[model samples]
Target chain A: MSRQASFGAGLWGGALALLLTGCQAGLRPIAALNQPLSGLGDSQSPSLNSNWLALISSRPGSRAQVQLIDRLRHAPVPLPGLNRPDSLPISVAVDQRGERLALVRQRDDRSELVIHRRSLQASQVVPIEPAGVPQRVSLSADGRVLAVEVSRGGLWQVDLLELP
Target chain B: MACTAVTALGLSGCSLWPLRRQPAAPAGLAAESRQQPALSGDGRLLASLVDRGGRTTVLLQERRTGRVLPLRQLRNRQPHSSPSLSWNGRYLALLVQQGGRRQAVIEDRATGQQHPLFLPADQEPQQLSLAPDGQSIALELITGGSRRLQVFSLAAMLEPDRAPGLLESGGGPPLQP
Candidate 1:
């Protein structure tokens, strides 16, 4: 090949190689999860685990409540006997099966922690020892362990409870 | 020689351009009045607290579709706060206020059962988080002017609510509830 022609081929070859490499290693578009959900009312305190999501929301002419949504089904799961008319839900956590829930509420004259069993249709009060006040609660994925924040002597402390 | 120089210039140009890219910004959810948002591990669901008509409530929405889900059981409760969800959204743990004090409770969605954690009259609950396995819970408590965080094992009290595929994958020995 002539010198000029060879130079032309080399330039084209370099450019083509660059183009092909760029296509192979190019950046991917943003994920759909990064997108925001619009047209929502005043809402806050969102918690998600796996395919389930739980949050607190209040709409016009409605009371504030804890809501649960199944991400796989894109629908709200019904929670019976969880919210009481005279009580205000302060915090909430959900298990993997959506079968067990742990929450704290203010009722009567004090704050307490309760566990709701779905299969048995029963609600039980898990008591804190040492007579300390309870605040926030967290549950393990297997529903085997519970972490709680307690207040004693005006200081914050964390306690682990083994449920039976 | 001219071709060689042109190729050199082109290769150098590529180096001059910035290569480190910034992460994409997260999309906005709603306007003001929304706070304390939590996302599931898979990023499929979102739960948030919204203020409406002077009351704070929990809202659950599918992140991809932006569809609002209903919470029929909590409709009557007011001023809900600090929401947490387990893997698959099966169990919801939260705190509620009744009368003058705050209480912690959990709602099981599968069977529509609500469990109330009972604390001593003097011990007051403030905030809480549930483990995704549905086996354990961590709570913040206040007693006699001090605050503390605690974790409790639920193996004896409640059955294991493991995520789908976890058990099949041999995650662990099943606990007898």
Candidate 2:
């Protein structure tokens, strides 16, 4: 084959190879959860560790609830005493092992922080005092650190809390 | 030789350009009235604000299944507002107005608990963001029509029963005269 022709053919082949590789990377699926989760509340604000997925959900005629699902079982793990008929569960964060939970409970008059440990079976309430009102709450993966978003005097601020 | 040089350049250009490109659109997310969508750290889930009939709600969806994971409408019966999600999708923060006053609230999505963080008496919080390590939030404060930026640490205000050393929490002891 002529040298120029050979070079052209090689270039075409290389371009095709490159194109294929790029297509594969772009099309690769990122999720393996094939089965659609059914009968769960419409989830919002999801936080995940390796084994657990947590979110806020609501059912018809009921207040908002926080749902923690075990990824392996795809079932809800009930968080007793965390939900009240009148109050709403607005946010949730679970520790690495899904053992510790940091959450926000909203009542008509005020909202409060409830940190609970599954193993300890104890829930602690931290008064978000002095700060204005809590907007968002998050916990470090280790469950030792807490972050709260607060609104005061018509402005927004984030408050960091260290839990014992 | 010229032909060889051209081929080499062509090959180099090809290497620089990706062969396949993924769609820019997020997987399976339908076009809706949703605004301010935040993806999880892993990009497997998305949280956004949806406005319907003058009501605003925060929605979460699993990217792969196109299934809307059940989330309670965070703004239902509350004021219509936008919220920011933490990088890990663990925390959601937003503004709420009650009794003619505005405030910020944080929700731990995992446990469905909500807490109120108090702001200064007269200053107003304009917007806020969570720090990546989930330790603090950068907040924009507005007072008397002027704006200021500030960083607030989670460890500083959340005084637990036991105190971790200042070095450990990266916060120094309170400054006193």
Give a tens-digit lDDT track for model 1, residues B87-172: 66666677777668776666777777666666658877666656566555555566566543344544444455555655732456
* Candidate 1 C-alpha lDDT tens digits along A35-108: 22112243433444445555555557776566666655645666777777767666666655676676777778
DockQ of 2: 0.01
lDDT of 2 by residue, B13-57 (tens): 212111111121244433343444444433445555555666666
Find the candidate with the highest lDDT and give its number.
Answer: 1
Q: What's the TM-score of every candidate structure?
A: 0.43, 0.42
| Per-residue error (Å), model 2, residue B92 | 16
Q: What is the C-alpha lDDT of each candidate?
A: 0.56, 0.54
Model 2 residue runs over 4 Å out of place are A1-36, B1-177
User: Per-residue lDDT for A135 in model 1?
Assistant: 70
Model 1, position B44, has a per-residue lDDT of: 44
Location of the lowest summed lDDT over 10 successive residues in candidate 1 chain A: A29-38
**How does candidate 2 score on lDDT?**
0.54
TM-score of chain B alone in model 1: 0.72
